[model samples]
Target: MTQPNTQIPDFQSIMLPMLNLLESGEVFTLNQVVTKLAEHFHLSKEDLKIKVPSGQMGLFRNRVGWTRSYLKKAGLIHYPERAKYQITPFGKDYLKGKPKDLRIKHLKKMPDYIEWTKTFNQDTNNKQEAEITKEIESQTPEEVLASTVDQLNKQLATDLLDKLKENSFGYFENFVIELLQKMGYGEFREDAAERTGQTGDNGIDGIISQDRLGLENVYIQAKRFRDGHVGSPDIRNFIGSLALQGVNKGVFLTTSRFSESAIKTASDSKQQKIILIDGKQLANLAIEYNLGVQVDKTIAIKKIDLDYFEE
Candidate 1:
């Protein structure tokens, strides 16, 4: 069989066709519309499998879903029962106009649509609302939300690293130990850890175990530097320190990045295993393990339970 076209229509482009499909006044489920719309667009198997950035839903289905929402908000179509939709008199009149395209701009001219938008815009300023609407027009809502969260996490990581740099060396050492423990190193055995507490103290800062029984130990060298790269000489010196202690494994944590030579030196070491955790990585770890950050807020998104309405 010949493959259908692979290009999925944008949400805006899907609006008119979708409204026309519903204007038959037959109540249809979302899955039914998704199937019909895919056929209408001649979307291929590859197109049907295409997912949004979050991989939560297919690209075509997501656009079609949002188109349904837009039509519903504009009072052109609505859910008569959960997960089922049908067109209204307004929708039939809308089709009679034979508009070139049904889009957010056309919906904005609708009083019901404007009022529905106000519910979401109550807390946002005019500029923010406009920006949000612009993004909604170009991208799926899930894509927009994911992009926002990624941007926030990056900024949070930068801020978190900056705070780490401002803290004292002792505090930084304690933080790294706590992070490692949280990650299952030393198995949270408080008795199996120690701090060197002095500068140039054989180039070692702390030590912890790799397992609960303390069968093996990992040496740590925590450097809280604000503005310089950890160099190869520093790594070699730490290696020497580990050799003095007769340890074969070490982790070097720094609030600044490591040089290429330093990384290579660690990788090339045959007798010892050295792990380097740079500032960005350190902050990300802290975030991942909830070491230095707290949950500020939680937002819950709700959707209809189709099974609840099923016979």
Candidate 2:
């Protein structure tokens, strides 16, 4: 009978030395480990990409942080101060009689190392299992779409709440404008002071085309509110301004929120269609368009060529 294949040591094996060095009570920073580990292992800085120390200046900060976190969780290391880490007593004991088989699976049996493998694996498995169950339950296209939209709305509301904490109202307004533009209302423009009427002199903040041409328009009123829901009277005043402009549509945007009555009054009007965008909806739109943000990196994976396998 054939024996099981042995597992090989990888980046984690290389990190063990750095951990050992820290256990010796020598004061060293993440930068010091990056350089020293590279030299001791006879590997170039590029080779250390998979094992650089956490939060250090490099492209591998994420990987380094993961490794550090795992080591700490296993009781091999502890943080002495913010961003400063040191090896534990358990790590020192392991270093004295280090195991010859340095595979990660074998490392779990070390006296100092707690078995986080089972716990971490179970947590990940549970999340994936829940997602699978959800997918199995959502058998129809409409169900899937509805679920996705609901998720989008919840995410938007949560993000808006987070932004409220930051108190960046101007950024929030610009975020809303970008969202509407992305929804194919590209003909929209900020209203001039002269065009703004009572409600307040500059009440209507923007104007959007009902169609491609400028003939039909939808007036917009944006308020950077922090407290209290917009009342029915606010909606009445907005509709009055829309009527003055001879427009059938109006959009009322607020950062705080709108009362149920305000939403009903806006939609209840038989002659006009007034759109109400509260803080929750605004966040959802921002996320959909990816406004004010850009992805910094992308990764692509490819399969090995199979033609050589037949040779």
Candidate 3:
């Protein structure tokens, strides 16, 4: 069956209606919000069923997630649990005005919102520069394919981080193990890798044998630090521990970014080979390797038939 090309309203357009849904100060799960907003916008069943390019979830759900994310960042809403939020006191106050201009510009007034927007814009700029190449008409086939591919990958990466944070430490350790395995470290899959976080081996999370016989090893440290940046102290401690174990290779993975000093520390360690994987890089790797991702669909763009003109 052919999918419809219908469009749902952008996040900015849904912002006001969404805030109004929670304006009464009642808590709602994401499903409730998505359903109510869909009704308000009068989206058809088919429209609500439109899957994102990843085919993981409906596209509308993805947009609504962003709507909640942006609002949550601006301090207008608070998450009581995963995918559930209660309107904030500030949210009620702002809704009292029945805001018509709840655009991103207005959201930027909040410092948190500014930071969130910066991260999102940076991702977009990165993809745009690499994939799009040059501006073309929206009707252009190449432009459409490249643009959608870029957007889908960005969404996938963001969602991966979101889900990873909600998981347990054991889950995260296994996730990192799986990621490395998918990255071609699975040749010695039998006993090559195991979680050591449970044993608390000098802050090392896991170790992957570089060879099946365990001749060489790569120490793994996975930190699911959600908020704070990993600094030089963390890197130095990991490296010092590696030296104590007489290991030369280590991989440090974090769901947060590493500070410049931390990055520099790894670079300056000539005795040990260290690789730092940030949340963004980790997600991108997962996407590239299909670790927690799948191919949604492939698009082919055909050009004019020059043979017809020659004839």
Candidate 4:
């Protein structure tokens, strides 16, 4: 006799029960649902982690959120409060008629599921309409593109930041220099304290040149910070150090984020043109340069040529 192949349940499988649990008057958090779903399906936490973080399970606090999102779009659910979700009369009817041998594949075959999918797509279209309206209200074409790129850069930066160790400040400094170099600022060197005369050697950490033979200099002050922002005082000291070195262009890089005052101070200073690169910017620079990361694939998008059709 041939053995039956065992099928492992996906995110939707776990979500249905969680939704059912919520409908049955059981209050549960995302963590609680994850635990219970894992046990019920005999799934390992690792397996659940992969699906939950990126799949439907991750869409809300629990499977309830995705269910509610779908059901609400289908007019089968309604939100009473910001976070609280409940099913509607249509949802109750759908659930009552739902098959006992419920599976993700089976759900697709159901009429209610098809209706929910259609409504879900329509809701998404409505959301896109709202976003387009908001964007049109507030920004110019150039500003919109710039804002979109900045958002993408920030998301990439956050991903890289998560991979870095908290105490690896030295590594962070090196990462920043490499990023700047990739950004067309070449002839760079680090920790050049040998040229500093007495008086405790000011606040500068390193000096980088844009060209050969140290002609055009860009001084840098690298701070390895864990918490608490870099203050205006720090910015002032960096400017003072730049003066001592007779350099007008300077970069202040830190692992920790900078305060608004620090940024304002740097911008407000008339003595020298100081550039402030905070933790977020530092990460973005790294991504732009592909310093510590590699590109897996490149996607190119193009539009149809209407001129060719006319010709």
RMSD of each predicted structure: 19.8, 14.0, 5.3, 15.0
Clashing pairs in 3: none
Residue-wise C-alpha lDDT for candidate 1, range 1-311, written one tens digit per residue? 22333477878899998999988899999999999988998887778887875566688887887788778768899778778989999989988988888777788877656544442232223354478768678987788778877656655675576577677999999999889888877765677777775866788888897777878998999999866579999999999999998989999998777888999999999999999998778877999999989887675768999999999
Give me the displacement of residue 50 in model 1, in angstroms. Answer: 38
Error of 1 at 284 (Å): 0.8
Cα lDDT tens digits for candidate 2, 1-311: 22211221234665566676687766666667656665665654444444222223343343345456556645677666556678888777767876553334445554323223321121323344457668758678667657755654553454354455355655555555556767767534543111242345545666666565567666777767644568899889888877777778777887657777887898799777888877666655665677644544443436798997986
Residue-by-residue lDDT tens digits, candidate 4, 1-311: 22212333533554456456556644445456556655766765444444332243432234434444444434444555445555666656667866354343445544544543332221223344457668767998678767756655554554465445343655655666666667877634443222222247587665567766667877777776644568999999889888887878988987556777988999998989998876666766677678777775444547898999995
Ranking by TM-score: 3, 1, 4, 2
lDDT of 3 by residue, 274-308 (tens): 99998878888988888878776665657899989
Model 1 TM: 0.55
Cα error, candidate 1, residue 25 (Å): 68
Please report, in order, the local distance difference test score of every candidate based on alpha carbons: 0.80, 0.59, 0.80, 0.59
lDDT winner between candidates 1 and 2: 1
On lDDT, the leading prediction is 1
Candidate 3: list runs displaced more than 4 Å. 1-9, 29-31, 38-66, 69-100, 108-140, 297-311
* Predicted structure with the largest TM-score when compared to the true one: 3
- What lDDT is reached at residue 305 by model 2? 84
TM-score of each: 0.55, 0.43, 0.76, 0.49
Worst 10 residues of 3 by lDDT: 123-132
